[model samples]
Target: MSNEVKSIGIIGLGSMGMGAAKSCINAGLDVYGIDLNEAALATLSDAGAKAVSTNALDFSQQLDAVLVLVVNAKQVNTVLFKTGLAASLKPKTVVMVSATISADDAKQIEQQLNSYDLIMLDAPVSGGAAKAATGDMTIMASGSAEAFSKLKPVLDATAAKVYNIGEQIGLGATVKIIHQLLAGVHIAVGAEAMALAARANIPLDLMYDVVTNAAGNSWMFENRMKHVVDGDYSPKSMVDIFVKDLNLVADTAKDLQFPLQLSSTALNMFISASNAGHGQEDDSAVIKVFDGITLPGVEK
Candidate 1:
């Protein structure tokens, strides 16, 4: 087997997947893209992918590596198995599962892939769409040595940082889930603080400036709270995305019999936002859950 991944197929050409596909193409790899969205496929085709299709099985056997960047484990399973992409692939092909799925789901997928004599990398990514577009995303990955070796080129093209969590199938997912706990909580708490400032009649822009420069600043606070200040609830990352992610955190904790007080609170905040019809809005819109505050750009 070659040490480099020369040709690759990407399943799910959403923002993140499209960015990775474009990065791979820019890196001079033979890239094939699969997505249900015609616009997404068209965009990748224009970006010089070797092929673009709605079905993963279209060119699954032709690829050296496959990156699954779908939304969840269910969608990942649907793309790989329901569409027969896994069975259609040539043996020894590296399948990098990059969804933020539960560790158990990652382990199950790994076992199934091993049954097909394919390599599986439990890889989950962060840094969102902007970073992905620049090929500067962070990847948390775990798999066998052979899998790592085969996937190195693709990783180099797609990520600024790739942490090898372990050789265990589920280790990467575990780490990503923990990371999501921090991300979700930070966004939720940041929204709460901003809402408090608004209720106190503090100018949101000034408050934002103070918080971002102060000791209490966090990456999530600085990033997500800016959306709150601008009142731009456009979905960079939707409230429902965090709802699903924090729910994953809750489910994982339940299985481990662990307590997650702050995460649990954050989960409720997201759920409340989702319940109030902000599910599709930017996650920073969680601040909308607090009433009696006049948000910027929002009419009373």
Candidate 2:
């Protein structure tokens, strides 16, 4: 671990990626943000990040680390192997795997990257786009001390809390699963509660305030109720995002002989909403699944 991490590169410039790029710039690191979307590049460039047009930036020789903040395992693989960026990386460059992936997948990826002699961090993030943009997200991470040493700047730039859960690459991902369980169930419960209140003729705004301040308060309640209040479904994080994450929960639990009935049920609810074509909408639209309530200004 070097005392100084002069520069780092980031792949993907979606909501989360943009936040991470901004965090890196705020940390005084020379940050190169890569994305296929020119508009995304322009935004990052305007924010003081160096924008690269392709996924093919070779950070191995010059970069201290490269953070992959893409949506899923497939995107991570694409940014690394398919795009030919991994091979071009300098030896021992910290590969910060920030996507939420299965523990098995994380281990396999770590093992594969080790063949290239790269330092790998099984790091998954939380705190959403706002947090990422503010450099205040939480990182659930596990990896070699060497990897942490190399990636400290990026981690410092992006995380307000970095939980080094364990050394095994899979543990960090497993913790992320536990987080998804609480997160998924909370969102589903919040949606159902709001819909139930609306169906029972209680004002949606009143219900939002009551539950948020009462014993039933949760992070999801705070996050999703704003959508119902504003009648906005534009995705800060989509329902389909939970659909994928909760499905990973089901699959991971089954493999571990763990029964997560509550999480499983919530996964189905999110899946149903996604199947009903609300996949791109904000996850708060899960309320739409409960039937018969007009959201004031919004249509179903």
Candidate 3:
């Protein structure tokens, strides 16, 4: 690998995927974006990206690196394996996997990619959509040296912090899973706090201000509280995302014989929120679990 990534391919154009594709374009790298959604494809094109309809349809085998930001294992396989993209990709063209996948799934995909002689980088991410759009996301990466070399431009363009966790493909996913545990717990706790404050007839604005400034604050607390305060359920990160992530955390812990009581509890809360038809809503709407409690300054 030359360590000089110029032309890149981005698969998926959802919120995070679009942000990442824009970040690459902002870094002066040529980006070929692929998505099934016509609106997302047009958005990428409008933003100066070369929008390709799909991974299988994109005629850019000259790509130095490919970034997979699709939903999960199934989508990853659909793009790389089903579309014959893995075989069609030029040798040493690094494949950066940014999806939130299980360790087993990561390992499986790594091996599958290796079969085509393509380098696989298990590079899951943090810092959400805003950070991604600003080219300031945190990447938890673990892969071969060659893979990293080919992915230099991607890391440069999309991540403010890239922790090269190890050489194993699944290590990054493991770390991301751990981080998701804390994130899910904090969001659940934040919802619980707002619910309690509302139930006690405490002024939610005052309570939110106090808790956010005090040691009780968290990133999720500050971010999600604003949604609760605004009664804006627009999904920055949807409730089902936590339902998927936290479930992964719980399953991983169980397999490792590690007891994570807090994560388990939070995972259940997310499940309940999802079951209550908040699955597609912003995760902050987990606060809706509290019956008959209205936020003072926000509409229901």
Candidate 4:
């Protein structure tokens, strides 16, 4: 358990996964990358990552840990169970789930993987794709001590801040759900503020500057609002992603009888933006829900 994770595999090579793969390479680990996108794999190959032809078919042979960076619990379930990705790995291989999902699902997955003699880390990542690529992302992880010991190198390579929450599986997912709630709310609020500024004839640029330096500022306002300002709504993170994540928050709260007013409101905002055909756009595009307000990217 004290041994280093010399060889590793990461499934789902999107922005976050791609960054992490590069970091693993930088850490000098033998990294195997898997994705449906050949172009992504090609890029990783250029960066010294071995591309897995059949997901874990090639990956299962030699990974010390497998980092899962897909979209949600359903995808996580498929990768670990439906796809034969799980059975391909050797005993005691740590399965790091980095997607934001319900804690229940995380626990269930951990239990299932344990039956196969595999280790599970309910590890969800933060700081977005930019941080992920630099090996400076924050990881909220909880699992067995053996899992963490084996995953030490991978964790060191992928994160600047790591909160080892507890030995229990799914505690990490609980914290991540709370993180998403704040993120989703802040984005929604920024959109509302910018839309209000447009309605008031205030210069969007000036408003951005004022609020950013003002007490009203938040990290999401600074980060996501720029996307709105530039009109570059290309999906760094899609509106529908928050729609899904915040909805998970809503569902989980309902089970506990916990009340979350702002989360509910923000979830609807994203749902509305997605329903109006902007779901594929960046989450910042939630600002587009305001009627008749000119957005930065639009021609007047």
Clashing pairs in 3: none
> Which residue pairs of candidate 1 clash?
none
> Which ranking of candidates, highest lDDT first?
1, 4, 3, 2
Q: CA lDDT, every prediction? A: 0.92, 0.85, 0.87, 0.90
Query: In model 1, which regions exceed 4 Å deviation?
Result: none
TM-score of 4: 0.95
lDDT of 1 at 34: 95
Which tens-of-lDDT digit does each residue in 16-57 have in candidate 1?
Answer: 999999999998999999999999999999999999999877
- For model 1 the TM-score comes to 0.97
TM-score, every prediction: 0.97, 0.94, 0.93, 0.95
Model 3 Cα lDDT, one tens digit per residue, 1-300: 357789888998887898999999999998888888888888888888755675544665768888999988889999999888888888777889999998889999999988888889999988878888999999999998878877887898999999999999889999999999999999999999889988898877888899988999998899888888777888888999999999899879977889999999998898888898889998987777767887644455
Top-lDDT structure, candidate number: 1
Model 2: residue 10 alpha-carbon error in angstroms = 0.5
Instruction: Give a tens-digit lDDT track for model 2, residues 132-247.
Output: 88989999999988778778888888999999987889888889988998998999998888888878999988888888889989988888887888888888789998999998
| Candidates 2 and 4 compared by lDDT, better number | 4
Query: Candidate 4 lDDT, tens digit per residue, 135-226?
Result: 99999999988888889999999999999999999789988999999999999999999999999999888899999999999999998898
lDDT for model 4 comes to 0.90
